[model samples]
Target chain A: DAGVTQSPTHLIKTRGQQVTLRCSPKSGHDTVSWYQQALGQGPQFIFQYYEEEERQRGNFPDRFSGHQFPNYSSELNVNALLLGDSALYLCASSKLGLAGTSEQYFGPGTRLTVT
Target chain B: DQQVKQNSPSLSVQEGRISILNCDYTNSMFDYFLWYKKYPAEGPTFLISISSIKDKNEDGRFTVFLNKSAKHLSLHIVPSQPGDSAVYFCAALAPTLYNFNKFYFGSGTKLNVKP
Candidate 1:
């Protein structure tokens, strides 16, 4: 089953511009999460969405926002992009379960380049 | 402040040799740990995981050892091959009242398996 799919594999935007990245969760999965991975660094959690609502968020500022549709698709929007925003935006999908047993499957990710 | 830290920036090993990647965390509240592998221009792929209650977990050629007291963990790959070359990231599951899937990640370590 198509693990996870993201759109606009590569995007370029200038400072102060906004961009929206999309993700389609794996088939049969319900939860979606977004992460930002800068060069030479591991991904940092941005937020998580379940049941069309944001369940948790990381230390990111208000500039970053996300939405999860009823069909389990997700969108990550970054407003006023900065040079540091140039990174790989990853999307992960998982089923809602107890705690942490079910592993999260990731997508190929969207590469955002801010000029 | 990075809650999880992979002290080693990079490691190189010959094929058929054992490769060890280490990670440490400053937060005691983290009860679960995971290892993810990533290649250039790709999102991280789940590799292995270990809970705080378990000291060691093994699967195939991969073995993850955890020392809760020291807040240290390591991933060992035996008979490493060229395909094993990638960036390895250590992630911690931070308990949250709302979202249990929240994860904190390290800077990651680059592993090079030379054939």
Candidate 2:
């Protein structure tokens, strides 16, 4: 089965511009989560979506927002992007309830470059 | 503040030898720890994990050890293979009312196994 999938493998935007990234959950998975991985650093949780609603969010500011569709796919939108926003935006999917026990499979990630 | 830390940025070991990766966290509330491996241009893949209730968890050639008291964890790869060369990331989950699966990640360690 196709694991988590993300669109726009690469992107470039200028400061104050906005960018939208997409993610498709793995087969048989209902939960979708987004993360941002800076160069040479581990990923930082952006937010999680379940049942079409945001279930959790990280310390990121309001500029970062996300949505989950009925089909369990997700979109991460970053408004007013800054130079620091240039990084790999990763999307991970896993089943709920199993939570921390089960592993979250990640997508290839969207490489965002902010100028 | 960075809650999770992996001081080692990279490591090199000869094939068939033991490779150890270490991680430390400052958050006492972390309930689960996990390790993920990533190759260039790919998302991080789950390796192994250990819950706070357990001291160790093993799966085939990978093992994860958790020390709650010391707030330390480590991943040990036995008989390291050349294929194991990649970036290893350590992630910790801290219990929270809002985000149950929220994870704090450390700077990944790049491991190179030589033949």
Candidate 3:
């Protein structure tokens, strides 16, 4: 069984440009969530996708968006990237069953560098 | 304000000894909590978790203790090894009206197991 997988292990984007990071959830998982981990800090919630729609979002701005495909894969798109956008973008997958006790498995993460 | 806080930024423990990492949260609504270990340039790996209904949960070498009154939780690792030297993050499951599986993470505590 494969764990969560993410594409573009590393990315470099200039200011005002947009970038899309891909993530394939773990086998038998259906929900996908994205997080941003800045240097010396823990991962912050970005948003979550379920049933091909964004179900939950954090304090992030509107520039950050995501989509969940039918196959349970996900894409995180950040538009008009700023220098502060440089961070490790993490993808986590979980099976949404009970109300509040689902464990999430994470991917290797994509390191995004906004130049 | 940061909801979840890991007061200790770093800790060093001798190999074969017990390592304890602490975390505190301000939100009483957090029903589930988790611990994750992360190395540089990698996403977090789920360690162990505890529910609000339970005071303690143990898995293999890891044990998590939750104190709801104090709003504190801890991860205890017995026989710490050099491979355990990494950043450890404490995360809480904050299920809101819109999202049932939202997570809030602390800034993390770096654990260094010295041989």
Error of 3 at B104 (Å): 0.3
Q: List the pairs of residues colliding in candidate 1.
A: none
Q: Over 4 Å off in model 1, which ranges?
A: none
lDDT of 3 by residue, B1-115 (tens): 6899999999999999999999999998898898989988678887888889999999988999999999999999998999999999999986576444778999999999999
C-alpha displacement of B69 in model 3, angstroms?
A: 1.2
Higher-ranked by lDDT: 2 or 3? 2
Interface RMSD of each: 2.1, 2.0, 2.4
**lDDT tens per residue, model 1, A22-80:** 99999888999999988878899999999998998898999999999989999999999
Query: In candidate 2, which residue ranges exceed 4 Å CA deviation?
Result: B96-99
Q: What is the TM-score of chain B alone in each candidate?
A: 0.96, 0.96, 0.95
Regions of model 3 farther than 4 Å from truth:
A98-102, B96-99
Each prediction's TM-score versus the true structure: 0.96, 0.96, 0.95
**Residue B44 of model 3, lDDT score:** 88
Which run of 10 residues does model 2 chain B get worst, by summed lDDT? B94-103
What DockQ was computed for model 3? Answer: 0.61
